[model samples]
Target: MLAAVFHENGGPEVIRVEEMDAPRPGPAEVRIRVEASSMNHLDLWMRRGLPIEIPMPHIGGSDIVGTVEKCGAGTVRSLLGKRVVVDPSLDYDWYRLARLRGYDGEPFRVIGEHTQGGFAEFAVVPAANVVELPDGFPAETAAAAALAGVTAWRGLMTRGGLRKGDRVLITGASGGVSAMAVQFANEAGAEVFAVTSGSENVRHVRGLGADHVFDRTTTDWGREIHRITNKRGVDLCLDSVGEAIWPQLLRALAVRGRLVSFGATTGPAAKVDIRLLFWRQLSILGSTMGTPAEFRDAMDMVFRGKITPPIHAVLPLHEARRAHEMLEAGEVFGKLVLDPREARP
Candidate 1:
C-alpha cells in the first residue's frame, strides 16, 4: 500500500510517498480501504510539530471516509463493505467521563494526532469510530466534512448553546471549522457574523451563509461587530484565533454571552482581563474534537446535504505534502481531499 508517511515531523518536505505494508484490523477494530481523506489544520500541526507524542512514521489525515474491508475479532461482521466516516476523536469514554465528572485527566487521543491516520490506502481504526453512511453517499463528501463538521457542531451548538435568533460571531471564518460553523449557525436560524483575513475569503464566508462578513486586514471587526449589533453585542462568539483578539472577543460579547474556543492558530497566550469576564458574566469554553455521538449528528446533516463542507480541491494521496503546504500557507478556503485511488506511482 502506498502512504504519505513521515519518519520525523518537521515540514511538508518531511512527507514521503512510499510503499508500506497495509494495516490490519486489531481486536474490535476494522481495516478501512481509504477512499478519501481530507486535510485539517491539525494535519499541518502534526506534520510540523506538536507537544504530544505521536507515532513515528506518521500518516496524518483525521477526516477519513472509506469502506470497511474487514472487521476484527468480536466486531460486527455486517460492517464489512459498508461506506463509513471515521470519527477522529478517540478515547471517548474517558473523554466523556473526564468532562462530565471532572475525573483525573485521561490521555487525549485523536486519530491523526496520536496514532497512524488515513493518509494511506489502508487504515485501521476502532469499529466504534466508523459511522456508516447511507447508500449512494459520496465518500469524498463525507471525508471533507468529517472532523470539521464534528468540531463546528460541538463548539457552536453543543458547547455554545446556540439558539434561534441568537447573534453569532465567528472569527477566522475561512478555515474548515469556521466555514462549517457559519453554515450551522445560519441553518439554526441565527444571524452569523464572520471575520476572515481578506476580501476573497470574506466573500466566500458570506456564501456559506454568514449574514455579515469582515476582512480583518482592513477592518477592526470587533468594533464593527459591536457597531452592527447596536452595542448589545453577540450572544455567542465562536473564535479560534486566540491571543490576537481574545480581549476584544470578550468585549464583543453580550452580557452572559458564550464564547467557545476550539483552536488557537494565532497563538494561545492571551492577556485576559478578569474584569471584562466577570463584568459581562461571560462563559469561556475550550472545545476539542467532539464525542462519537456528536460526530454522528455532524455527519448526518452533512450526508443529507443540509450542510455542505466546501471542498477546496481534491489531490492524489501522494500530494499530501502539497496539501500540507497549501493549508499552512492559508491558500485553502475549506477542506482539501486526498484520493487514494489516484496515488499513481
Candidate 2:
C-alpha cells in the first residue's frame, strides 16, 4: 500500500509517499480500499507537531471515503462491499458524560492523529465509525465534506444554537469549516457575515450565501458588522481565527450572544476582557467535532445535497506533498481531495 507519511514532525516537506504493508482490521473493525481522502488544517497542524504525542511514521488524512473490502471479528457482515465515509472523531458513550463534566481521564482520539489514517490505498477503522454512502454519490465530494461538514454543523448549530433569522458571523470564511458554515447558516435562514483575505474570497463567500462578506485585508470586519447592524452585532459568531481575531469577535457579538470556536489557526494566545462576559452577558464556548448523531446529520445533508462544499481541486494520492504545500500556503479556496486510484502502479 502507498501512503503519505512522516517520520518526524516539521513542515510540509517532511511528508512523503511510500509503500507500506497494508493494515488489517481488528475485532469490530473493517479495512477499506481507500477510494478518496481529503486534506484538512488538522493534517498541517499534525505535520508541524502538536503538544501531545502521536504515532510516528504517521499517515495524516482524516476525511476518508472508501469501499469496505473486509470486515473483522464481531463486525457486521452486511457492511462488506459497501461504500462508506468515516467519522474521524473517535470517542465513546462516555463522551457525552465526560464533556458535560469536563472530564478527561481518557483523552479524545482522532483517526489520523492517534492511529493510522486513510491517506493511503488501504486503511482500517472501526466498523462503527463507517457510514454507508448512497449509490452514485461522488467519492471526492463525500471525502471533502466529512470532517469539515461535521465540525461546522456542531459549532454553528449545536453549540452556537443558530436559528432562523439569526444574524451569524463566520470568521476565516475561506476555510473548509467556515465555508461550510456559511452554506449551513444560509440554509438555516441566518443573515451571514463573513471575513476573508482577498476580493476573490470575499466574492466566493458571498456567492455561498453570506449576506455580508468583508475582505479582511482592507476592512475591519468587526467594526463593519457592528456599524451595519446599528451596534446590535450578530446573534452568533463562529470563529477559528483565534488569538489575533478573538477580541474583535467577542466585541462583535450581540448582547448576551454566543461565540463558538473550533480552532486556533492564528496564534492561540488571546487577551479576553472578563468585564465583557458579565457586562454584555455573553457566552464563550469551545467546540470540536460533533457527536455520532451530528456526524450522521452532516453526511445525510451532504448526501441529500442540502449543503454543498466547494472543492478546490482533486489530486492524485502520490501528490500528497504538493497538496500539503498548497494547503499550508493558504492557496486553496476550498477542500483539496486525493484519489487513491491515481496513486496505484
Give the clash count for model 1.
0
Tens digit of per-residue lDDT, candidate 2, span 171-212: 999999999999999999999999999999988999899999
Show model 2 residue runs off by greater than 4 Å.
99-105
| Count of clashing pairs, candidate 2 | 0
What is the alpha-carbon lDDT for the whole of candidate 2? 0.91
Candidate 1 C-alpha lDDT tens digits along 132-176? 888888878899998899999999888999999999999988898
Assess every candidate by TM-score: 0.97, 0.97
| lDDT leader | 2
What C-alpha lDDT does candidate 1 achieve relative to the native structure?
0.90
lDDT of candidates 1 onward, in order: 0.90, 0.91
